[model samples]
Target: MAPCVTEWVTSCTNLILSATALHSSYRLFKDHRAPSVGLFLLGLSAALCIVHPSGSYLTSIQKEAEWAGEVLAPALVSFDFLWLSEDHNTAHILLCGSCLLLGLCDWLSADALTVMTRCLGLSSLSCCLTVCLFAGNALGALSGVALSLPLLVAPKVGAITFAPLISPAAAEGLVKWLLKGSMAVGCWASTRALSMFLLDVTDRCNMGI
Candidate 1:
């Protein structure tokens, strides 16, 4: 298949998977008495996953590097001013702060999901799957955010400031690889979580529990 076709296929698949996961998560929340804050965090995490760029179109547009850069420049500038800066220390501080914030989110999500699973009296497999899903989502979100900073934070400035750095193409390739890894982790987690949840539901129905 053509590259564009392949990219579209992948993007569609991701969208479907993310949607399914989000639905399952919402249902779980509805069935349990989770903290309001937990619900908000999980909802936000799911939203981020849904809205994050897939870069599928890059395959076609990368051919016009200059044009792509021109189109992306304004957005990049805004991202830098808002989240990154020329000062090395400031950039590091921002990156660390973002990571810390997301880390807290991940911890809260995992704890909430764990509590819900236990409250439901799910089997060990079901509990494990839920935890795996949380871990996967957390890792994926964090990694995606980390990869995005370097890509968007004053690419030209970073190139000059950080000596012995890789070329732009190399950096882009690295980011793409990391992005794929994150997606893989998410896919694995979501599939397991959904399967286990369904299985639990079936068991409950059969046993009238």
Candidate 2:
């Protein structure tokens, strides 16, 4: 069936464009600046898939199957299986570690870093810190899904699963805080309004207007 261009307008592509605009807005706000809980979770999801349980990084898929029976399914509620194995838990550690690394690195700068610069966060030594890390991250995430398709659909020869992140663990702590700073800042922003609403409704009934 030939589809509707109008409906497609509200799809993932649209949402991403909107997010880019918001991200840009946040950057402006910082100067402006950026991500929070929601963005952190989203970033984590992309990272895990790239570093798939099979691990194209530390090792190839075949070498890690026994251990990766561990990573396939995302921990919907917690990080239990993620860091569960203690010693050999490469997949979980790398996935979560990436977020923490990014958060801690970005805090040093006053301005928001781009995806190319994301890797710089991993290393203070990166000369093209902005391009190597931040821009790399942005590219990785935008491309992460398409990269995971083969693993996601292929028959499971191993115990692991390449999946999207769904739990709080994915966000780490600092990353979530960065992404959701606006939410926190907004909370502070709404406090005066909240106070007036509360006082108007309960304790101060004597006002005439």
Candidate 3:
């Protein structure tokens, strides 16, 4: 029961982290100058899955004879034993799976937006507005990640301790701050660009120059 509870907590935490990473990636991609940052974050998020324990250790447990005697031994036994481990492997799986899905959504959303703009022959103002709106959403989502950055990086500190001279928590905090700043800058720039585009359109119509 204690193990199950731990798994639930870990799973929930991973879900939050994965969601934030995905949101950050989406917003970063919307910024023409920041797509590289978004891609970096997306890659980082995927790398988290690699660090996640695969739960293979759960299989090391000795099974009861009756459990092993089942007709569909592999399926039934494995399913029943999934949540019994201390490492919360089930939670890791859920976290990785959610990240995968969110990454897909991010990609699809960007692709769809690009296709729509091209197909509709959107004007510069329209394109600017679309990007601004998307960047705003990304900024909102990134705030969640920034708020939860500590929790997200806590589990990795031990592994990072083996390295020389760097404190994992401090490093993570710096990275989080940098990412937040970058996103904020992108949002501000997009808003400014949109305003300029609107002003240009208005000038073109009014001056006939």
Candidate 4:
């Protein structure tokens, strides 16, 4: 498939996945009583779905809109992870802080900042992943990896496929789209899996099952 078409298809898929996840999460978690945490989850899901990268394909101001999904969405997820954590240790704060800083640096177009953004973005993912694993939410850790790996990988893939080799732009674009789709999946899957796991534990406790 052509690069443009592939990008379109990937974007569409992410939109559907994110929208579905948001709807499903609302239905599953509403009225669960943990209002603060629930709102954070729903809010993050909604933000990812609404500010999705697909908008860039349709909007005239593509570059500006792209940041919402590329940077803001994952940053919000990192914040949500920290907020949901039972303990706010220094490491967790630093990790989440790195994720937030990456988002801030994302807006700058400096060549020097590009490397910083990539390193910090990857580190942010690790931060979230560690936080989730420490909290015993394996699904959340998986989400962090799926959604953020592309940030670092896309550039290298682009470099490898540059010029006559294979159109670096296409390879990079494809990786980015996959990243967006993974964000959708991560947002939905982590929340859904965690909710179901908690419910199961609660049920077993009550029923002695």
TM-score of each: 0.27, 0.19, 0.26, 0.60
Q: Go through the candidates in order and give the clash count of each.
A: 0, 28, 0, 0
The predicted structure with the larger lDDT, 2 or 3, is 3
User: How much does candidate 2 score in TM-score?
Assistant: 0.19
Candidate 1: residue pairs that collide: none
TM-score of 1: 0.27
Clashing pairs in 3: none
Residue 190 displacement in candidate 2 (angstroms): 39
Q: Rank the candidates by lDDT, best first.
A: 4, 1, 3, 2
Worst 10 residues of 2 by lDDT: 73-82
Q: lDDT of each structure?
A: 0.35, 0.28, 0.34, 0.55
Instruction: Give the poorly placed runs of model 4, Cα more than 4 Å off.
Output: 7-11, 17-21, 24-60, 89-107, 162-167, 193-209
lDDT of 4 by residue, 37-155 (tens): 32344334434434434555544344433433444344445555554443346446644555555466647666656666566557657766777776677776776676566455645
Query: Which 10-residue window of candidate 4 scores lowest in summed lDDT?
Result: 31-40
Candidate 1, 1-209: lDDT as tens digits: 35565455545544553454344345444432221122233333333433335585743333233222222221221222222112344334433433343344345575553343232222222322333354343432332232223223333332443335665544544444344344334334433333444455567679986
Per-residue lDDT for 28-90 in model 3, tens only?
A: 344322222432343344334323455655322211111111111111111112222222454
Assess the local accuracy of residue 44 in candidate 3 as a C-alpha lDDT between 0 and 100.
43
**Model 3, residue 183: what's the lDDT?**
32
Worst 10 residues of 1 by lDDT: 69-78
Instruction: Tell how far residue 131 is off in model 4, in angstroms.
Output: 2.6
lDDT of 4 at 176: 63
Candidate 4, overall lDDT? 0.55
Worst 10 residues of 3 by lDDT: 65-74
